[model samples]
Target: MRIARMHLNESPFKPSRLVSSHVSKYVDKLNLYHVEELEAEFLKKLSSYTKLPRESISLYPGSSEALIALVRFCRSRALKLVSIWPSFHGFVEFANMEGVGVDFVYLTPESFELDLAKLTAVGSRSKALYLANPNNPTSNILFQDKDTLDFLSSRFGLVIVDEAYFEFSGYTAADGVLDYDNLVVVRTFSKAFSLAGARVGYVLTNQELSEEIGRYTALFSVSTTSLASALGALEDIDYMMEIVKKVIELREELKRDVEKLGLYALNSKTNFLFIKTPTLGRVLARSLSEKGIKIRAYNDRLIENYIRVSVSSREDNLRFTEALAALLRERSTVG
Candidate 1:
C-alpha cells in the first residue's frame, strides 16, 4: 500500500536550492554556539522582506516557542486571553499549563466565520486576543482586509495575530503591528518556506513590546544552520512563491475532488483543506488509515466531524483523491 502522511501541515516542497546550498556551507559550524551576527542578518532580511522596521521584529526557534513566550508573558501579567473556539490549540494548552484563564468566542456553525459581534461583546473584558487568520482546521480567512485589526483596535486588550500560513493566504497583520501598539503578529517559515525541521519563526510588534518580549527570548535558541537557511529562503522569495503556487493549484484540485466524493471541503487560503464528513471524523480517519493515508481528525465540539488534510504534491493529491473516491463509493454501496 502507498503511504501518504497528510496530517501535519508541512509543505510538500523542500527549501529553495539556495537555502540548501547555504546550509551545506555552514554544516561545519554545528558544534559552535550560534552567533548574533547571523541572527542579525536574518532579521535584516526579514525586515526587508516584510517591509517592517527591524526593531519591531524578534526571531525564535519557531512560532510555537514564540507563542509559548507570549503565553508566559500573559500569565505573568494576569492577562485574560480570548480566542476563537476550535482554532489552534497551542496557546490554550499553554494558558492551561500556566493556569491562566481563556475565553473562547465560538465560530458560526455553517460558515466557520468569526463571530465578530460576540468577540466585540467580550473583547473589552479580556486582556489579550489571539486571532489565527486563515484559521487552522477550518482553513478560512476570517477577513479579507484589516477589519479584524480595526475591530480589535477599538477594544481595550492586546491582540495576537498568528499568521503561520501568511504566504499561502497573503493576508497578514505584520503591518498592523506598526499601526496598533497593542497588536502583535506571529509568523513561521515552516509552511511556505519549507523549513519545518529548522524551526524558524518571528514576532512583529512595536519597539517597546519587542524589547519587552526580548527579555524572555532565550539566548542561542536558534541554531546557526537555521539562521543561514532562513536567510537563503528570504533571498529567494520567488522560489518559495513558486512552490506556493503549485500547492495552491493542487489544493484547489483536491477540494474539487473531495467535494465530488460528497464531502464538504471548505474553501481554504492555506495549504490544507478542511472536509466535513458525513459520519464521525475519527471513523473516517480510521478508514483512510486503512488505506495507508493519514489525516488530522478533530474531536473538538465545533469540529468533531471534520478531517483536515495538508495539501501535498500532485502525485500524492491524486492518490488521496483516488483512495477517498474508492472509499466513499464502497461506503455508499454498503449502505
Candidate 2:
C-alpha cells in the first residue's frame, strides 16, 4: 500500500507584480541589505494592522522558530506550560524538548470550544499558555467572549495566542495586548500573506519582553527576500483581504459539500477544513493520491477517521469531488 501527502490549498495566487517589480528587483538584481532594515519596515507596517505598540515586535524566520524561542525562554525559567489539546501537534513536542511541565485540557468534539471551568484550575500553576485561536486540525474557534479571556489574563503569567489564521477569521486578541500586560499574539505571513516560502513571522508584546525575545532569537532570523516580500505583501492590503474573502467563501462551500457526503465539518475559519468520515478517511486519501490530488489525513485515537483539506479554488474542489466520489462508489461495489 503506497501513501502520498498533498497540500490542499497553497498561496492560490502568485506573488504580486509590485513585489516582483518594485521591492525585490533591486535586491535580486544587485543591491542587497541586511534584513534588519527590511524587518523594521515590515514590522512598522504590521503595527498598523495590529493594535500593539510597534516596538513590541520581534521578527523571526517563521512561526516555528519563534515558537522554539518561546519554549527556550520558558525553559530557562523552568515554568510549567498548559495548552488546550486539538491544537498544532508541536505544542507537546515543544514542552518535552524544553523539559517544561505540560498540562492539557481537551475540548469535547461537539462544541470544540474551551471548557472555561476545566481551565480555571490550570492558570494558577501555568507559567505560560499556548493556544491557536482558530485551532488547527479540528479548526474549532474560541474566545469570541470576554469571560474566558479575562479569566486567562488574571491567572496565567503569560497567555500566548497563535493567530496564524486570523486573516480569515477577522478576529483577534492582539488588541487585548493593549489591556493585558501578560498577553502575546503570534502571527505569520505563511497563511494569509501567501509568503510561506518567505519564512516571515512576528510576535506582539510589550517592548521590554520583545527585546528579551529578540535577545534570545537569531540575530538575522529573517531573510532579505522574505523581508522584501512581506513588505510588498503588506503594501497591497486589499489583495490580501480579497484572497481571504475567497477562501472563506470556499471554506463554507466545502463544509456544505462535506455534510452532503455524510461527513461533518468542524467549524473552520482557516484556509483548511477538517472533515469527519467514519472508516473511509485512509481509503479516500489513497484514492485521491492515485488521482494526483493531495490532502492531510488524521486518525488519532480521539479524532479517528478524518482529514484536513485546504480550501482551494473551484477547479480543485471539483477535482476532489470527482476523485472522492469515485472512491466511494468503488467501495460500495466492493462491498
Candidate 3:
C-alpha cells in the first residue's frame, strides 16, 4: 500500500539534473563555515532572475524563516499583524507565540474573495499586512486588482505578500517592491522548483527595507548546498516551467473528476485544490489515509468540511478519485 502524499503542496517531480549536479559539487565543502564566492554567485543569479537590484534581495534558509524575521521586526516596532483567516496557519501561530497582536479578516465563504473594504477598515497605518496572494487552503488569488493592492499598500504601515506559489499563479508583487518602499514580496524554491528539501527562499523589497530586515536575519543563514540548488534551479528555468505546466494540467483534470463525483472543487491557481467535501474533512482524510492516500484536513470551524489535496502524478490522482468515490458510495448506502 503506497501512500499518495498529497497533503503538503510539494512538487510531484524531482529537481532538475542541474540542481543535483550543482549540489554535488558543494558536498565536500560542508566542512567550511561559509562559501562566500558561491553565495555571491547565487545572489547575482537571483537578482537577475527577479529583475530586481541585488540590494533589494535577501536570502534565507526558507521563506518561513524570512517570515519569522518579519514578524519579529513587527514586534520590535509594536506593529500589529493583519491577515485573512484560514491562511498559512504557521505564520499566524508564530505571531501569537511572539505575542504580536493579530487581526484576521475572513474571506467570503461563498466565493473565497477578500472583502478589501473590510480589510482596509480593519487595517491601519499602524499595522502590518501579510497576505498569501493565491491563498492557501482556498487555491484562489485574493488580490487580483492592482488598484486595490495599491490602496492597501498605502493604507498599511508595512505590507508583506507571500508569493510561495508565484510560479504556478503567474502573478507577483515583486515589481511593487520598487514602487512601495514598505512592500516586501517573499518567494521560495520549495514549490515549483522541487527544492523543498534544500530550504531556499528570498525576500524582495526596497533597498532600504531590505537592509533593515537584513539586520534581523542571521549571517550566512542559507548554507552552501542550498545556495547551489537554488542557483541551478534558476539556471534551468525551462525545466521548472515544464513541471508547472504538467502540474497545472493535472490539477484541472483532478478538479473535474472530483466535481463529477459530486464534490465541489474550487478553481485553483496553485498546484492544489480546495474541495468542499460531503462529510467532515477529518473523516474523509482519515478514510483516505487508511486506504494509503493522504490530504490536508482543516480543523478550523469556519472550513472544517474543506480538504486541500496536492496535484500528483496521474496514477496517484486516479487512486485518490477512486478511493473518494468508494467512500462516498459507502456513505450513501449506509445513509
Candidate 4:
C-alpha cells in the first residue's frame, strides 16, 4: 500500500520539465573554463538581487555544508556556539555532531520573541550565536527589533542568520555585513528557487572569513550543475516572485484553515506554517495520516506538540486540509 505523506514544512515543490526553460539561454552561455566570470556573474546577480556587497558572498554546495563550515570555523577560533531555541534544529544538532557544546537561550512561545536581555547575559561567555531570520518552526524573525539586532551585532563574535526563507519574508540582515565582520548570512536555492536538487547555497560575510572558510574546504564545494542552474534560477526573478506571492497568499489562507480547527498558527513569513496542536503534535499528525495526509511534528521539551507544514500549490494545499479536516471531524464526533 502506498503510504500517504505530506511534508508540512518549507521545501521546494517539484518543478515541471519546463521549470528550467525560463533560463535556458543564460545557462547555455556558461563556459566552464572562464571560472572568474562564473563567480563574478553569480555575485553580480546576487548583489543585484539582494543589494549585498558583491565581495561578501561565498558559494557552497548547499546550506548544510555552508552551515557546517561556519560552525566549524567558530569552534576552531575557540568560540562557543550560542543559539536561540526553536530556530533550526541543525544549529544544535551540528554543534553536538561536531562534538562541541552550544548554549541555547529558549524564547518564550507566548511572546514568540527573542529575549535579548537574557541572551546578553549568556552571550559574552559564548562565542557565536545562530538564528534563522524567520526561524524554522515558529517563523518568528525579529532582527528589526533594535534590541535584538543591536545586542547581536555589538557583542557576539558571530551571528549566523539563516535566511533560507527570505524570499517569503522580504527582509534581510545582510546590510549589517558591511558594518560588522561578525555578521554571517546563510542562504540556499532550496526553498525559493525550486532548486533543492541543485544543491546550491551561499554564506555571506566579509572577504577575510570567506577566504578562511574556503581555505581548508573541498576543491569543488558546489558542482557545475548547481552553478549552471543557480545562474538560471537568478535570471527568473519574475517567475520566482510570482510563486512567492502565491505562497504568501496561501500561507494566510492556510492560517485561516488551521484556526478553524481550533488551532492557531504562528504568524509566518515563510511558505510554511508552524501550528500548535492539542496533542503531542503527532497525535494530530497521525490522525491526518490515517486520512491520507502527512505533516511534521516536533518533540521539544520547550514546545511540545508543534508541527511544521510545507506550503504547496492550491491543489496540494486543499488536499492537505481535506485530510486534516476529516481527522478533526472524526475527533469531534468521537468526543
Candidate 5:
C-alpha cells in the first residue's frame, strides 16, 4: 500500500510552475556565490508582497533559523522565553539549547483557549513572548482580538509572532510591526507557497529589530535558488491563494469526517487538524502506520490523547478516514 504522508503540515500541491522555471535559471550560476543584487531583488519583491518597508524585512534559510536567531538575541539580553504550553516544540527546544530559561502558560484543556489571567501573571517573570498564531498542535488562533495582541505586545519586552500559516488564517501581526516596535512577525513559503525544500523564510519587524536579528544570522545564508523560488512565489500569489483555498476546504471536510467517526476535531485554522482520539494517541498512530498512514502524536502529558494530521488530497483523506473507521470498528469489537 502507498504511504499517506500526513504528519507534517506541508502543502499537498507542488509549488507554482514559476518556481521551477525561476530556479532553473540559477543552475549554471551555482559555481559563484549569490550576488547582493539577487538578495536586493528578492527583498524588493517580498516588500511589495508583504506591503512592509524593505528595511523591516530580513531573509533566512527558513523560519526556524530566524526564530533561533531571535532566541539567541533574547538570551543575550537575559530574557526568558514565555509561550503557551504545547506550542511548537522546536522553539522551546531551541531555547533550551541556548540555555535561555523558558516558561509556559497552559491553554485551557480541551478548548485550548488562551487564559489571559494566567498569561498576565507571568508577565513580571518573562520579557520575551513567542506565540504561534493559529497555534501548532491545537491549530486554533489564540488571540483573535487586536486589543489582546496589543496588550501582550505592550506587556512583553519583545513579542515574536509566528505566522507560518498566515495564508490560511487570513490574520497577521505583520501589520502591527510598525505600530509596536517590539513586535516581530515571522513567515515562510513552506506551506501555502509549497516551497518547503526551497527553505525561504523572512522576518517582519521595525528596522532596528530587523537589523539586530540579522546580525545573528550569517551572511548569504539563503541560496540563490531559494531566493529565486521565493521571488517566483511572490510573482504568482494567485497560485498560492488557490492552493490555500483548496487546503482549507479539504481540512474542513476531513474535520467533519473525523467528527462523524465520534472523534473530536479541533476547529483548525492551519493546514492540519488536532484530533482528540478515543484511544491513546500512540496506539492510534501505530495502528494507522500499520495501514501505511502516518500522523503526529504527542508525548506531552496534556495532549497525549491527541493526534495531528495534515490535510491532503481528497483520495488520501478518504484513505485516512477509511483506515480510522476500520480501527474504530475493531476497537469497539474488542471492547
Candidate 6:
C-alpha cells in the first residue's frame, strides 16, 4: 500500500546533500552543547540568507519554540492577543498555556481573505497581532503591501508575522522590521529546505525586541547538529529553490484538479491547497484514508467540511488526484 502524507504540509523531498554531509561532521560533538561561537557563526549565515542584520536574528529549536517563547514574553506584559480564526494554532495554544486569550477575527466566508479593517480594529486594542503569511489551514495570504504595511506602521502593538511558508509564497514582511519597531517576523527551514526533523528556526526583529524575546529561549535550545544542518541548508539555497519551484508547479496543478471536483479551493500562495468540502468532508477524508492517502480535515464550526492538502511530488499528487476523483465520482453515483 502507498501512503500519501499530506496532513502536516511538509515537503516530501529530502534535505540537500550538504545537510547530511555537514551534519556528519558534528557526529563526534553530540555530547557537547551548541557553543557560543558555533551559534554566532550560524547567525551570520542566517543573516546573509535573510538579508537581516546579525543583531536582529535569534535562533530556536524550531519555529514552534520561538512562537511559545514570544507568547510567553507578551503574556508577561499582560498583553491580550489578536489573530485570525483557523490560522496556525501553535501560538494560540501557547498563549492559552500562558493564561492569555486571543480575540479572533474570522476571514471572509467565501474568499478566506483577512478583513484588514476588522483586524485593524481588534489588533489596535490587543497587545500583539499574530498572522501566518500564506496562512495555515486556509493557505491564503494577507496582502503584504498596503494594508499590512499600514498595520505594522501603526501603534497596534507588536505584530508577529509567521512566515514559515515564505520560501513557497515569495511574499514576506521581514523587510518591514527595519521600519516597524513592533514587528517580529519568524521563519523556519522546515518546509522548503526539508529540515523538519532538524527543528531549526529563527526570529527577526530589531535589537531591543530580539533581546526581549531572547530571554525566553533556553540556553542551547538549538542543538549543535541542528545549527550545522541549518547552515548547510542555507549553503544549498539553489537546491531548495529548485524543489520549491517544482512544488509550486505541482501545487497549481493540484488546485486545478481539486476545483474540477466541484469543491472550492482557495487561491493559495503556499505549498498547500485548502478546499472547502462542506457536507462530505468526513466522508471524503475517510474514503481517501481507506485508499492509503492522508490529508487534513476540519470539523470545526467555522471551517466545517474543509481539507488542507500538501503539494507532494508529481507521482504522489497524481495518485491523490486520481483517488479523490474516484471518491467524488462514487458519491455522485450513490446519489
Q: Which lDDT tens digits does candidate 6 get at residues 11-68?
A: 8889999988888888787888756666777788888888999999989989999999
Query: Quick one: ranking by lDDT, best first?
Result: 3, 5, 1, 6, 4, 2
Between prediction 3 and prediction 4, which has the larger lDDT? 3
1-335 per-residue lDDT for model 4 (tens digits): 34344463545455433446633634554455335666677779988887777778888888888888887888889888888887788777877888888778888656568876777787763478888888887876656654566678777878888999888888888777777778888998888777888888898888888788766357766755567678877877877887788778888987898898788788888878888866677787777677666777766766676877888766667777777777778777888
Candidate 3: tens digits of C-alpha lDDT, residues 118-196: 8867878889988898989799998766786788788899999999999999988887888887899999999999999
lDDT against the true structure, each candidate? 0.85, 0.75, 0.90, 0.76, 0.89, 0.84
Q: What is the lDDT of residue 142 in candidate 5?
A: 85
Would you estimate the TM-scores of all the predictions? 0.95, 0.91, 0.97, 0.90, 0.97, 0.95
Candidate 1 lDDT, 1-335, residue by residue in tens:
77787998999988888888888878887888976677777888899888998999888999998988888787666678888877888778877876777888898987999887887788773478887988987899987677767888778468888999999999777878888888888999999999899899999999999888767769888889888999899989999999999999999999988887778888899999999887778887888899888899977767878889999988888888897788778878999
Clashes of 6: 0
Model 2 per-residue lDDT tens digits across residues 100-153? 667788876666788777777666734788889888777767776666778888
- Model 2 clash count equals 0
The C-alpha stretches of model 1 lying farther than 4 A from their native spots are none
lDDT of 5: 0.89
Backbone N/Cα/C clashes per model: 0, 0, 0, 7, 0, 0
Which consecutive 10 residues in model 2 have the weakest lDDT in total? 1-10
Candidate 2 vs candidate 5, lDDT winner:
5
Number of clashes found in candidate 3: 0
